[model samples]
Target: MAKKELKKVFNLNSYEWWRNHRRVVTFGLFLSIFAFYLGNPFHKEGKVKDTCAKLNSSFQITGDEAMKKLNLKEIKNYNNRELANYYCERYLGIK
Candidate 1:
């Protein structure tokens, strides 16, 4: 007897499914990754504040002021270390 081909269980492999749920899929993936990183064992929540505070003292500004200077495309999208890196790298012109 010949074996029949198995059908797909879901439409996830279909282009139309992706087209219909592009935003949803993208958002869910983003949230999942964000949550994963948030739960990381060595993640520090105040590195940005500490780094900014230290960097700011050199410029005679406050930590809040340094963060205020950050030109984030979406401020809410970043965590502390990411914000610090971006701010120091881009805003403060640090390497």
Candidate 2:
């Protein structure tokens, strides 16, 4: 009986299996997306703030000054403050 069931399961087509389990697949996909959104590193403002504080304490400089002093690459789309925040976050591995 077990061998017969195993054969039947193994013989099932991939498309037919997917069609039968569409609700489970959709739920799993939704869960994966929700987890990704909740755990996204780039959205952590507290980390950036903490990194900026650490940079300020260690270097006595603002993010803009640190960007120039470290010779970090400039991103044209971001303003000076945003660029500084990004630099601080990246340089310190906060992101």
**Predicted model with the maximum TM-score:** 2
Candidate 1 lDDT by residue in tens digits, 55-82: 5455555434545554334357565445
Tell me the lDDT of model 1 at 58.
54
Candidate 2 per-residue lDDT, tens place, 5-90, comes to: 88688974468888899999999999999998988776566555565775657556666765665556777876655677667767
Backbone clashes in model 1, listed as residue pairs: none
Q: TM-score of each candidate?
A: 0.31, 0.39
Which residue runs of candidate 2 sit more than 4 Å off their true CA positions?
Answer: 1-12, 60-95
Q: Least accurate stretch of 10 residues (summed lDDT) in model 1?
A: 1-10
C-alpha displacement of 80 in model 2, angstroms? Answer: 9.0
Q: List the residue pairs that clash in candidate 2.
A: none
